[model samples]
Target: MKRPKFFYLIAGFFILAIFLAGCAGQKGNEQGKSAGHPNVLKANWQDVLSQAKGQTVNIYLYGGSESTNNYIDNWVAPRLKKQFGVQLNRVPVNDTKDIINKLVSEKQAGKKDGSIDVMWINGENFLMSKKNNLLWDSFSPKLPNVKKYVNQNSPAIKNDFGEPTQGVEAPWSQAQFVFTYDSNKVKHPPKSAEALKQWVKQHPGKFTYPAPPDFTGSAFIRNMLYETTGGYKQYLKPLDKQTGLDNIVKALWNYLNAIEPYLWRKGETYPESASKLDQLYASGAVWLTMGYDPAHAANEVKDGRFPKSTRTFVLKDGTLSNTSYLSIPFNSPHKAAAMVAINFMLSPKAQIAKSDPENWGALMAIDPNKLSSKGQKQLNAIDRGKATLPSKVLANHRVPEIPAGYVDYLEKGWMEHVAKH
Candidate 1:
């Protein structure tokens, strides 16, 4: 049974190779399954706070607005670091969808350790993340600010598009669609879709909108659709429940084409995005530029990006409005820090700064009435700048957003009906 010396040496070498291969495989498997386990659930606020200190949290958001970038970078980051000993890193993205996509990839690769601590997501992007189970568990209810300042039962707080948030995301800001025009150039701004069409024809080559798929352009269609087909009430329900969708959408197409001929370049092309259109308006190449943010013109004016004469208006019929939110990713390694950051952002102090025109001029998501008399006084004193409308004016013209499903449908439909046509 004894083997030759050379034979035994060869056998030992083969066994050693198998052992090395097994070790390498195990190491690879571990990396592939590197899950983020911040484990903030079942912990008290104090415990979470203690754990969060000295941690760095990354917040991913659309970086289109320089004011927003500065607000978070300068105003918010310092406060978070000073108060909680936590570092807030800003990870500006071109699209919020990219965060969901990144999380989805991480999940597929069995990577539990993900980089996105929090994301500024809403509407269709939130719907997609929820559908794919790309978000972390119910964590918002754990925050003291949510319990104190937020109305838990309001439909606006409960839902994102049509999907229930169920304590997964925290409401951060409110946005309403508004058209920005140079007051010196636009004597009488359009009040409705028909009026807008007439104005476009009269002032040929003086107006243009960002192409559809751009957030601002997509919103323009949705606002006009409300005026043309009826109002937003019909679209409040789920997409499947609504009927005669095709015929209803046809009216929107006609309205768009009618105005297209009078667009800045004769409808042969469009500004690639809202920012591009803003640049055009700033330079007086176009008379109008529009955005979902009511205070956007004010911020632009403060930054000298838009003319001092720029003013904002919503369609007399109605203006589309919705809430944007922050949520932790499913595999975020800094769950405690993420929760702390979100809670702080929801606090009255942070919201007031966000609402200030000098900072970002974003609408406060916090229910202002929920604050005490002193808190209310502080909030009321923040002048939202001249180009921004009063709260009552924006709220009076405000209309609810359609279900996210409908948003997707229109984005695709625009390509077929309007963009190509």
Candidate 2:
């Protein structure tokens, strides 16, 4: 009887150890999701949507463009509210670079619950944010639209200014460099950097680009760097990796300086902002203006801001094309809602609405070939207006952007080299 009692006691001890082991394993799995996101990554789409409902996401972005502002306020916000039960509150800043600086400050202050849920970001801002680890985990891949629509193999999708996105940002819209001219004033547009220099010399005080540190102006310099230097392919590597970069930039400064005397105000002063430049063009103070938006000239015409003769043209060699993205902050309290919002923005239906010039006139970020037959038909149906170039023409001349470091270097160099002299 004593031996049988001892055997039962041993069995009870063994079972107790097994139960404790299972509990420890369960705790470890819970701790694995330590980002304080409440398991957004592991949850299914339905669960994410359930968590996103009634969440108000704060979207920070550049608020200068009237169409961009109207699109967010009137179109995107209402649809997001009705469809997902998520509220999108857009916080506009004069510059998006400030948003990056704010995130850096928030991180240093050890603020665990940041207010920025999603931000419209790209280029040097994205680079700085990634360096500081201010972005949330690899959340882009988890977005259903990105998985279905975006081209997974494209180099542009994988990298931002040569920095790996690592699934931290979702591409929303694409814009390319195009010169806007009033056809009544100018019969033929220049097709290359050299041709533009001659056009300025021949038609003095009729053309001018906004000063640098201005986003459009800075892009203008980058495109010139490619045209003046041997094409852009050589500069695709990191800026530091480029040999004789100091010497290569001199040609750009020279080209710009050569055209300085013929510029509006004789190069003594430049329109302070792209908007100011656009105003000059509107008032007929200048006959031409430029921007990253290919549809910009067309939209201006439709809005009665520009003449009906307004037309857009790209360089013969190549034109700069950049994609802007939506990113989630590291400490965002509503990651689920941000993801849901970004995913919706990437969808075919939303992109189609955004593509209409009356809406936003932005080019859809997703590939057309990847879309369903119905979706592709809708995208193809967008008029894009007479001022906007055909898709095939823009596509043929598109060039990938140089790394951000080069952009920063060139923007500063313009101030020292071209602006001062």
TM-scores for candidates 1 onward, in order: 0.91, 0.91
lDDT of 2 by residue, 187-271 (tens): 9999898899999999999989989989999988899989998899888899888888889889999999999999999999998
Off by over 4 Å in 2: 1-37
Error of 2 at 110 (Å): 0.8
Q: Where in model 1 is the C-alpha error above 4 Å? A: 1-39
Task: Judging by lDDT against the true structure, name the best candidate.
Answer: 2
lDDT of 2: 0.89
Report backbone clashes per prediction.
Answer: 4, 0
